[model samples]
Target: MNYVILGAGPAGVTAAETLRSVDSQASITLVGGEPEPPYSRMALPYLIYGKIDEGGTYLRQDPTHYDQQRIRYVTGRCGGIDSRAKELYLSGGEVIPYDKMLIATGANPIMPPIPGAHLEGVETCWTLEDARHILKLAEKGSPVVLVGAGFIGSIILEALYLRGCDITVVELAPRMVARMMDETAGGMLGRWCEAKGVRVLTNTRVTNIESGPEGGPRLSVGLSIGQRAPADLVVMAVGVRSNTGFLVGSGVKTNTGITVDDYLQTTAPDIYAAGDCCEGVDLSTGKPDMLAIQPVAVEHGRIAALNMAGHKHRHRGSLNMNVLDTIGLISSSFGLWQGAQAGQTAKVIDEGGYKYMKLEFEGDKLVGAQCVGMTDHVGMLRGLIQTGFRMGGWKDKLVASPERLREAYISVAQGGAVGGADVAARQHAACRVPWRGERSLAF
Candidate 1:
């Protein structure tokens, strides 16, 4: 059997490895658009920060990892898929036939809808080439305007900060990471960033970017607030979309992304989809959703490989989770952090202290959480929500005292059915304080 994976990112690499393990004799071809070792875009910021060189961004540290696995790497973008012919067409007109195919093409960076984005000094921090461009352009004390404060944008802030660049973040949303974090949690992050000397402009847009005649640094960004800011470099980390445009004529179905079932198989048989290019079920909403996180992509690849190799496997669905660090402040949003309209909520907001936590519950069961400046008990909260266990009275106690997560967890996770009053008595007697940064409580 020949398995062809149309990406060399985390999804495609994992799928190749899993397939090789499952069906040793099967021929595997991993295709990629860029001419580089399969690397994690998530690590690009660290590369930019001089923490690691280009080699460190690679997902597989060993250069011969793929070669040792007997996986063939093809450097090309898949131009089209001829399902009937079982042939994949590459942009350079290479035709590769496959017995089974996995489309894990992933997503592409999106430039903000502003003029002059194509200027020489503007780049997106999604690929190794982009990192090289940034290294050359963003020097010490460079005036850098990052046009979004989302996950990717926030990540690169540290790198730019280390470069000693003056960063001005512009986000149309009212707060940083608005899609992942609520206003309270996000507001605290924005303020924290400000406290650390990052110029944050929330609820603002970069309406236009006028480049100088020679390009590179001599540019002006027109803002919605009636101000034009000069920028030596502009990083467009606004958003990204699945790279499924090449699948237009294919029989495979697509909404926001390629639709796949629990088996990670596409609408067409023997054709699988995964990664940012595919939309699967969300555990909380029980609806089709796309989360372009690397870990989710890895799981998708594993499941797709198992199914492709004629093994019984179904994806349990990925839960929503995001952790971000801006300046010195850390924040995370998981599950339905924005809580439903009729659900009960427990909120703790200490704006002065730069700490916040919001727990959403649906009748004694924790459903979601949003947190800022508090990392302890995050894992506990995650387990409580993911396990879908009835907290009973512990839920109310947690509502009253959000920091009693250790107590709530101990009550519910004592290895069996727990009685409420007894659990409360035990919590009152021995609930551990100093839970902040307590690693044991986290897990």
Candidate 2:
């Protein structure tokens, strides 16, 4: 069978490897627009921070890895797709035919329409080339203005901090990470960043940017607050949209992204979609959404590959989740962190300790949760919500003391006809926290 993946990101790479494993003799082609080998955009911040070299961003270490596996890698930008002809068209007029195809083209950063945005000092931290441009300008003590405080912006904020750049974050939302975190949790994160020497201006927008004096800063960033700040560099982390423009006229249905069914199949029978470029089902909402996260993309790739190889696999859908680290502060949200409509919510806030937790429950089952600073046992929130188990009497206890996740998990395990210390031990084993930069242990 001939299999072609129209991306070289995590989803496409994984799909190619999986197809090679499942059907050894099948022809596999992985196409990417970038000239470099398939690399993780997540690592670009680390590259800026000097933690890793450009090669470290690569998905595979060995240059001959793709050749060794017999997976053909093509470097070209996709101009369009001919779904009926089963052909992929590249911008350079090259055509590749495939029996089965997966669209994992991923997303591109959204550059907002602001005056002076096209200035040489303004850049978006989305690609390796962007990182190179940033490295040349974002020097120590340089005044840098970050235009967003979402997940990607927060990460870039930390990297810029490490590089000794004076960063002033301007976010249009009332709080940082507004999409992933609630007001209380987001406020805590903003305070944490401010405490760590980041000048955060929430509910503010970069109204305009312009070339400044030659001897000093090169850019003058005008904010909606009627003030201008001179900046040597400006990084736009506003947001991203799926790269599905090429899918237009291809007979593939798209809404925000390429819409895929539970099987990851597109409108065309042999065409499938995955990763940030596809609108897959969200476990929390039971609706399709463009979840541009790495874990989701990886899983989507594996499942889509299985079904493409004739294994008949159905995706269970990806949970809505975000785990972020701003300087030293850790914040996370799982499932529907934004409280469900008419659902019960439990909040525990400690502004002094830079800690907060909010739990959303529909009846006795955990529907969503958000946490900041208290990272030790929070993995239980994901476990509880994903398992869909009834907490019974433990629900009230959690409402009163949300930190007692270990106890709640144990109670649910024991109530499920399990007994003794064995259940407690398994509960501990099951409730692993998902904090980054720290060992994930049970509470």
Candidate 3:
């Protein structure tokens, strides 16, 4: 068997490795557009902070990991696919044939249609080359203007702040990470950023950007609210779109991304799609979602490899999850933080101490949650929703405390909800706040 994967990201790399593990004799070729070795995009911010070099960002530490696994690495940009011929053509005139193919091209940073968007210093922090340029120019005390306060933008905020750059974030939405967090939770995060000395402009748009004669980043940004903000460096962290342009005429169904079945197989037989470039079902809404998170990307690759290797496997759906840290404050949202229309919700707000939590419930089950300034029991949030644990009488108890989530989970997992006898005592003894100082995770 021969496998050709059209991306060297986490998804593509994992698929290749999985295939190699399943069918050792099969020829696996991992094609990547970037010249660097397979690296993790999640480490880009750390790269900016000088905490790790380019080599540290690589997914594998050993230099010859791919070679050792007999995985051929090809550096070429994919132009298009010949579905009928079962071949992929590269821009440099190379034609590769495969019995099976996985398209995990992932996504690219979306550049807004602003006037000075294509200027020299106006860059999107997506690739290693972008990081190199950003580190080169983003000196200490540089005045930086960020165009979005979304996930990637918020992540870059910490790096920029740590680097001592004056960053003014302009978000069109009323709150930061509006898609991931609700108004209340996102608003708290924005305020937290502002308290850390970062200027946050919400519900604002950059109408125009004026550049200098040399095409430098001396940008004068005109806002929707009629204000001009000077920028030494302009960072466009607006959003990301699927890198599915290469599949334009390839007989693949693509809307926002490549449409696939439960097996991650595309419309064309023997061809599959995975990662950020694929549109799969969202478990939370039971509707199709892009789900461009790293964990989803990795799982997409694994499931695609299984089906490609003739081991039938199905990806039920992907979940919407995000954990963001701004300054010293951490916030997370899982499933659907805004709550379903017919679902009941519960909340606990402590603004003075900057703690907040809003738990969503669909009848007797937990559906979603939004949390800020707290990380304790966050792992349970995804579990509670994913497993559809019947909260029953425990629902009201959870609403009352919210800190007793661990005890509730243990109770539900062990069999059923416990009686009200030792509930308060269990919460006090068992539930230790899960957020252990920046060691929080969300799925």
Candidate 2 Cα errors over 4 Å, as ranges: 413-443
Tens digits of lDDT, candidate 1, 1-443: 99999999999999999999988899999998899989999889989989899999998999999899999998998889999899999999999999999999999998766777777778899999999999988889889999899888898887898888999999989888989988788788888888888899999999888874475467788889999878888899898998899998899999989999978899876799989999977878978888999878987898889889998776767778888877768888888898966889988888999889899999888889988888876777767776676889988998899878777877785432556676555444334521111123312
Off by over 4 Å in 1: 213-216, 414-443
Report the Cα RMSD per candidate. Answer: 6.0, 4.3, 5.6
Per-residue lDDT of model 3, residues 71-127, tens digit only: 999999998899999999999999999999999999999988998787778888999
C-alpha lDDT score of every prediction, in listed order: 0.85, 0.89, 0.86
lDDT of 2 at 338: 85
For 1-443, candidate 2 gives per-residue lDDT tens digits of 99999999999999999889899999999999899999999999999999999999999999999999999999999999888899999999999998999999999999999999999989999999999999999999999999999999999999999999999999999999999998888888898889988899998999999998778799999999999888989999999999999887999999999989888999987999999999998878889999999888887898899889998776766777888878888989999888788888888888999888899999988989998887786767877887677888888998999878777876684443556677766657545633111223321
- Greater TM-score among 1 and 2 belongs to 2
Clash list (residue pairs), candidate 1? none
What does candidate 1 score on TM?
A: 0.91
lDDT of 1 at 430: 33
Model 3 TM: 0.92
